[model samples]
Target: MAEFDLIERYFTFEYDFTQASNGSANNKSSQKNKKPKVVKGIGDDCAIFEIPEKYQLVTSTDTLVDGVHFFSDLEPELIAHKALAANVSDLAAMGAKPLAFTLSISLPEVNQDWLKSFSEGLKNASKLFKVPLVGGDTTQGPLNINITAYGSVKKGRLLERNNAEVGDDIWVTGYLGEAAAALELYDKALVQKAALNHSEAELWKALTQPIPPLKFARKLTKLSRCGLDISDGLTADLGHILSKSQCGAKVCVESLPVSEALVNFVGLEQARQYALNGGDDYQLCFTASSKHRNKILNLAERCQINVTRIGKVQDEGLQLNLNGQPFESNRVSWQHFNQ
Candidate 1:
């Protein structure tokens, strides 16, 4: 299919840019309820947006290459979901409300079934995350999906990795290591549908779906400034916050959040390794004052988000403890372009 035809057939939206840009919806209710931020979108050389007068915009782009990011044989729907979710997760780490997103996909070929599933995946995720798909490009090439997500945050509400205080408590939302474990097992054909075990089945699902803590991260904006999404494992990603904050951390090995599926599949020691150095979990790792512990926990419960305190910020360098004794590891998280 031609590029324009492909876009219209699979990615058209109900957004009326003419009405939205002029701020002249048919009625007050329409204008009040669905206040569009886009001044001009799609079908244009450049999409134009009107940022709210009092808010700052946050945007990020994440790309997934065919073999490097996922198995080429994986379903296109999953590929679409993961590509967009990765971008949205970055916005969440900065405590921003998802505004809109654009997709730029390069396809090996225009397979009708694949495009249908892919578009459906993007539409589903766009609704689930409350982010609209405004515009993007689709071209014929090696299969690659790049999504750029835009978001907004009130003034002075943006979270930063450098804001961690020496005495701040380190916390992570949801669990970790399952995605990495799922990848490891899948590559080995140990998670086949025809012969799947319970834990293996759960791990496979984790591999396909990554839910970012968008709402939970928004709630934390008022409570914490030092934060980041854990795409690169707890130890390494936490190093980023500490490095930027010019401090250190003391992480308790036993406290790392490993799901039951991971433990059952790989046992405690291996699970800890994955939790420490595995990647693609996309959970938020953040730091806030110890004084906010109760408040944080209360907020997590209210948000229905599981948050675990795995460590604390310190004065000097990264430290690990196991059973109250000093511990160390040679493992490292996934690094891109290391070659």
Candidate 2:
């Protein structure tokens, strides 16, 4: 598609540039103009604002490119949702409440239809998180969208991955292999025909719209020794936690949660592999003292998100215990070189 066609199709908005630029004129002419509560959000040089004291500002930024991160054929709305959700997941790992975000977009041209759908997706996500768009930049280029999200940490509690100690019980929120199963289904055109053991729609939705586990972060802060959001596959991201914590882990492949959708579609072993090595599932992988495991279970029940006891922290270097055997790899996670 042509540039304008693409933008119109993907990012439609009736932005009146004249009105946007003339905001200062209106402000100057107003007789009873109260001071602006915050700086220009959507209509200014930059998102101007002040954050109150007693709150730590948490920020995360991510970029998604058409050919590199996502396929052009995917829904524009889903594209927007995933882009925002992935960034929000970072804030979740830090135990922060999302506050706002800025977007930097580079597009070939304007496609109103695509813009409309994409903006709707962004709006939907913003409403879900109550995070407003403060400001951002737009320019001409191949399709790329970058979002920088901001959140606030309560006085002194923020989960960091470097705090895990030996004997901390490792846990992960939600099932592991469903997303990998969904990806396999997407790649093989194997979405379930019948409702057999699981919902095919759910798998597809999980693949498209990953939920950010920010809501559970507060409960996690109370119980976690250390935490990180799982994006770079279980083995790779967990390796991050281990390296930062100066510890090792023994992951029980049998103990990792696999959803019915994955079991039905991909059987057990392939599902296990996907669960172990699948990247892009934005679940939380955390370590806590053994003393907190029961309390953590109760918290998981209260939050209504699945909590799995996946592994334990050891006193040594990184190692894996899959199917009761040692599994070793110098390489972990998805690398651009492999692709």
Q: Per-residue lDDT tens digits of candidate 2, residues 1-339?
A: 664454344433332222322235346444233221233466556765544454578899998888767766677888888888898989888888776788889878677777778889987877777677776767888999899998777656788989988888888888775665676456433333344334666777777789977888766887774788888788888888888888888788788888887777778777777788777898888888988878888888888899899888898776566778975443346766676
Residues 229-321 of candidate 1: C-alpha lDDT, one tens digit per residue: 999888889999988989999999999989999999999888888889888888899999998999999999998988999998889899999
Clash count per candidate: 0, 18
Clashing pairs in 1: none
RMSD (Cα, Å) for all candidates, in order, is 3.2, 6.9
- Where in model 1 is the C-alpha error above 4 Å? 15-36, 187-191
Error of 1 at 276 (Å): 0.7
Highest TM-score scorer? 1
RMSD of 2: 6.9
**Candidate 2 deviant stretches above 4 angstroms:** 1-40, 187-198, 327-332
